[model samples]
Target: MLPFTYALRNLFRDPSRLAQTVGGAALVVLLMVSAAALNHGMTQVLSASGSPNNVIIMGAGSEESIERSEVHLEAEAAAATGIDNTATILGTPAVSGEITYQAPIRTESGKEEPALLRGVLPKALLVHTTVRLLEGTFPNSGEVMVGKLAHRKLGIPENEIAVGKTLYFGNVAHKISGTFSAPGTVLESEIWFDRNDLSTLTQRDTLSAIYARLDNPEDFDNAHVFTLLRNDLELSALREDDYYSKLESFYAPIKIMIWLTVSLVAAGAIFGGLNTLYAAFGSRTREMATLQSIGYTRKALLVSLLQESLLATMSGTLIALLIASLFLEGITVPFSVGTFTLTLSPSVLITGLTTGLLLGTLGALPPAIRTLAPKLNKALRS
Candidate 1:
């Protein structure tokens, strides 16, 4: 077996190659790890949206956006009756019924982007614990509420956002009022309005979907069948946590892409790693020959080369993870998983480290074996 120091030193023997190999591997690992984190972040946002006791009621087929679900007022009324008044935030009713939809709004600065719009009673603030007025006041009629994202993507202002800023939709103009946050939620993607106001703009005169809060998640066991029973309802109920989980599933393609990209880049990285180790050994064959002549076992030589490869790749992995942690912290890219605020989770960190080690072994073995396999008899005369 190689001395640990000996393996470590070999990687730096050629400073230029070490830099090239480590830097390239760092870039590949950084991207792969970050992408994995983003994918996990999406899942986290959705998962965090609800506790065990809360539930959501939406149109039968409306998966990603509750905006697309259109339920009648009576169906909403029945669900509202089922609220577990006990768990309500601040002693209010547990259920904060809301109407959710979307509208097109132009920014004060950037290009036009559609803002997700929601309508809720004042108690929605009290009911959804995660929601609060980050600044300004709650919305009023002809007034609008904006998400942090709405301001960023559409360049709208929330503080200076007026009570009468008109958001022009299809043929209607809705007013802006105040700002609030249901951060890390589907609500962050939306603008709030009076449900009646939404009905006026879209002319549906009914809610798209109704969201409910419950005291315990178990309250939902029979609720789905109940919601589905009304022939006229065409609505389904789910635990708020579960409802968001379903939404995260919509982003499965993004996760797949992350794996696909990392797999491809890491494949190239494996080659680069192999090439680096190959060169390290190729330049030292004379030394190897001498060692063989001195009675060192070929098996030990093989182990040494493999050890060196592991050292270089593991070093590269640690560097990648450190850089990822320090640089990528608290960064939230706007993505919608129902209402989740997707951010990297600890699980993703572990995944990156595991990949690095695996890449090290797979990347190192081939070249190590090739370099250590030569004959003892041919070289003495040469």
Candidate 2:
């Protein structure tokens, strides 16, 4: 068998071919890594945003979108009174009536972009247990609280929306009261307002939804039963986690499109790399035949060729990882509902490594075998 150094030395034989193989592998791996990270981040944020112990009560036929849902303002009091096994703190039922609105609002810089706005009472903190105030006080009349990552969704710098800054809604300006964070959840991309303030500003008398926190997951049935029994309320009850799961399904098409795009682009890169390998191996046929005459087996030659290919592809994988760490990590991406940050999790890293191995081994096979196929004398004389 040829020494391993023989494989290593052959990789540098043609500088252009080496660069092509490495660059192609890098592009393919990078695309796949990015797609995996994007899908994972989006799915995680949606899933983490909801809690199994919480239930959302919305108007009938509006289960798909909270922003479109409308319920009587009295529903909050009714649910608090009717639902059993609800979580309570100091004898106060953990129920919050909220209004959700999406509209473009101007920052202090006069920049306008669409923002997800939620109107809630202080009791909102009871039901959305993940939320924690990062700085300043909660909003009062003419004041609003911003999420820690709200600036990402608004396409502005964080300092632009710091506490004490101002946001304009129509002709009125609201002070930035504080910043809050709900880690790993979509709530981190919203701006929250006092329920009454939002109702007056949006000119809506109804609540968009009622949030109730139950003592346990099994207590969801009690809330569901309450909704069914109250025919006059026209309310539909759904578990918070289930609602977000439906949202995840709603975004399934986007995830599919991402994979489709990666597949098409990676197909082109794979074919291009294969062609480069074929040409490079074809030109080395005589050299392989001479090695065989020196008692090196065809199998040994094939292994050496694969070793060379793996080295190039693995180098490309390292380059891709470096680029992702520098540019892709912690990138905040905003969508219709919220924003998510891209991360190179363990699963994404494993996927990239596997892709590089497959490209190097399977992509090099046909060319390596073909180059060694000729009779030893025939190949040497060619």
- TM-score of each candidate structure, all chains considered together: 0.84, 0.98
Residue clash pairs of candidate 2: none
Report lDDT per candidate. Answer: 0.66, 0.95
Q: 278-338, model 1: which lDDT tens digit per residue?
A: 8876667667777778887777877777677666666777898888878886665665323
Q: RMSD for all candidates, in order, please.
A: 3.5, 0.9
Give the TM-score comparing model 2 with the true structure, all chains together.
0.98
Q: How high is the lDDT of residue 340 in model 1?
A: 34
TM-score of 1: 0.84
lDDT of 1: 0.66
Give the C-alpha miss distance for residue 168 in model 2, angstroms. Answer: 0.8
